[model samples]
Structures are given as structure tokens and as C-alpha cells.
Target: MALQIGDTAPTFSMVDSDGTLVDLSALKGTKVVLYFYPKDDTPGCTAQACNLNENLDYLSSKGYRVIGVSVDSNAAHTKFKKKYNLNFSLLADTEHELVNKYHVWVEKSMYGKTYMGTARTTFLIDENGIITDIISKVDTKNHSSQIH
Candidate 1:
């Protein structure tokens, strides 16, 4: 089922790019920007990651915690974050549990071929861990203000 606004974000514990285990339940006092992207280092993904990187200070000042989730492994995430100087955490979801729980794991078709992959979706979660907004219209070029 698609997680709607006001729904409680599924509690998950995933390894971050730095190999730290981050549990959603532990961040109850802060707003969270949980973004799910298709992959790492790709054009759109890079743009989106950069946008978040540039505005991280602003987001943090507003009491928001930004986290990116993808099917990429910890090693890949570490390389991508280091190469791009990303300041936030990229959660590794190799098992696809969180992806499926949030319903971002979707069927996509490109170049006349179809495959199952994550859609570029984002969830704006509140301090109480309830989803406040859902951004399924991710255009990488304009991702910065999409959270606002």
C-alpha cells in the first residue's frame, strides 16, 4: 500500500553510507526528509543529491533531518557520497524491505524495456514520525524547493 500523508512511517533500521545503523524510531524528535531514489551516481540522482547537499544546512536549521534511501550497497553509497561531498546519510536498502513498505519500489519502463525499480519519491515526515507530505513528482533539476 502507498503510504499516505498522516500515516506513520514504517520503522526501519538500515545501514547508512558510513555503515552506521540508523533506526527511524530513534529520530522521533526531528522532522525527516526521507527520499528514495532509483540509483547512485546517475545523472538525475546526482543532481538530486547535490541539491540536497547544497541545502543541507538550511534544512537542518529548520529542524529537518534528511536521509536518502536506495537499493545501493553501503560501499556504493560511500563512494557516491564521498565523490559528491554529500553531507547527509544515504540509507542502504539492499533487501528492498523499506522500498516495498513505502511503495516506492515500482515498475518502470525506459528505452522500451521494463524493469522493477524505485521511483524517485520522497516523504516529508514530522517530528512525531507521521508523514506530512509526499513528493512523487521529482524533477531532479528542481528538487531543492520541492521540500518546501
Candidate 2:
């Protein structure tokens, strides 16, 4: 089932782009923007990541810690972050645990062929760890303002 607003976000720990282990529980009491994208360095994903990066100040001003997640390796995340100067942390869900927990993994069709992939989705978790909002149909550009 898709995650819903008011549900406690599934807690998971994974390596960040910096290769440091980051636990979601450690971020308690801070509004969080946890986005799940399909991959790193792809056009749509890059645009979405950069859009958020460009509006970090506004997000922070509203008390949110923006974090992106994908089924990518830490090394891949590092390169992607550096390539785009992304200010947010990207969690590497190599095992797909978080992806499954968040229900972003699903059937996708490209060129009329079905495939398993992440559905570009974003969640707004409140300070208390409950999901405050969910944006399943994310628009890559102007995503930050769109969320707010």
C-alpha cells in the first residue's frame, strides 16, 4: 500500500553519499522531505534534485531537512551529488528495503514493456515523524514550491 499522510514514516538506516551511515531515527524533531527517485544522474531525477537544491533555503526556513533516496550505491550517489552540487543527502537503498517500505517500487511501462522501478515520489514528514503530506505525482521542475 502507498504511504499516507499521518502515518509514521518507515524508519530505515542507510549509507549516505558521504559513505556515512545515516539513521532516520536520528533526525527526530525535524521536518523532513524524503523523496524516492528512480535513479541517479537521469534527466528527470537530476532536474528534480536540482530543483530542490536550488530552493533549499526556502525549505530550511520552513523547518524541513530534504533527503533523497534511490536504489543506487553510495559511490553513485556521491558522484551524482558532486556533479550537481546537491546540498541534500541521498540515501542509498541498494537492498530496496526502504523502497518497498515506502511503496515506490511498482510496475512501470516504458515503450509498452512492463518493468519494475521506482515511481518518483516525495513525502513530507513532520517533526513528530508522522507523514504530513505525500506527492506521488511529482513534477520535476518547480517541485519545491509545488510541495509547499
Candidate 3:
């Protein structure tokens, strides 16, 4: 089931692009914008990440710490970050741990072929770990406005 607003955000501890551990519990004192995307370097994913990168200062001003989760390997995330100059951490959920916890892993269809993949979803978690919002239809280019 998808997580709902007001539910306590699921806990996650994953490796970032730089190999540092990022845990939800470790971010308790700050609001979190946790986004889950299908892959790194894809067009939609790139646009979303870059859009967030562009508005990082604005998000920071609003006391939001942005994090992106994907099934991509840490190496892929590192390249994507360097290529796009992304300002936030991209968590590598290679084992689909966080993705499954957040219920973003689902069956999808494209070109008449169906397969299981990561869904584009974002969770806005409050300082107390309760989710304030969930963005299921994320507008890649104007996402920060939605968060604000």
C-alpha cells in the first residue's frame, strides 16, 4: 500500500553516492523531501533531479532536506550527480530496500510490455517523521512549487 499523509514515514538507511550512510532517524530534526525515481540519467529523472538542484536554496530556506532514491548503483548515482551538478544526496537503494519500504516499486507498462519498476513518488516528511504530503504525479520541471 502507498503511504498516506500523517502516517509515520518509513525508516530507511541506505548508501549515498559517496558511500556515506543516510538514515531517516538521523534526519529527525529536519523536514525531508524524499523522492523516488525509476533510474538515474533518464530524461524524466534527470529533469526532476536538475529541477530540485536548481531550487535547492529555496528548499533549504523552507527547512527541507531533499533526497532522491533509486535502484541504481552508487556508481551510477555518482556519475549522474557529477554530470548534473545535483545539490542533494542520491541514495543508492540497489537492493530496493527503501523503494519497497515506501511502496514505490510497482508493475508498470510501456510499449505494450509490462514489468515491475520503481514508480515516481515523493514523500514530504515533517520534522517528527510524519508524512505531510505525498506527490504521486510529480511534475518534473515545477516540482519545487508543489513542495512549497
Q: Which residue runs of candidate 1 sit more than 4 Å off their true CA positions?
A: none
Scored against the true structure, residue 63 in model 1 reaches a CA lDDT of 89
**Model 3 misses residue 128 by how many Å?**
0.3
Q: Rate the local accuracy (lDDT) of all candidates.
A: 0.91, 0.91, 0.92
Candidate 1 is scored at a TM of 0.96
Model 3 / residue 138 / CA error / Å: 0.6
Candidate 1 lDDT over residue span 1-148, tens digit each: 7889999999998778787778899999999999999999999999999998898888888889889999999899999999999988999889999899999998999999999999999999999999999999997876768886
> Which regions of candidate 3 deviate over 4 angstroms?
none
Residue by residue across 30-145, what tens digits does model 2's lDDT show?
98999999999999999999999999999999999989999999899999999999988899888989899999999999999999999999999988889989998899987998
Ranking under lDDT, best-scoring first?
Answer: 3, 1, 2
Which scores higher on lDDT, 1 or 3? 3
Q: How would you encode candidate 3's per-residue C-alpha lDDT over 21-103 as one tens digit per residue? A: 88999999999999999999999999999999999999999999999999999899999999998978899888888888999
TM-scores, all candidates, are 0.96, 0.96, 0.97
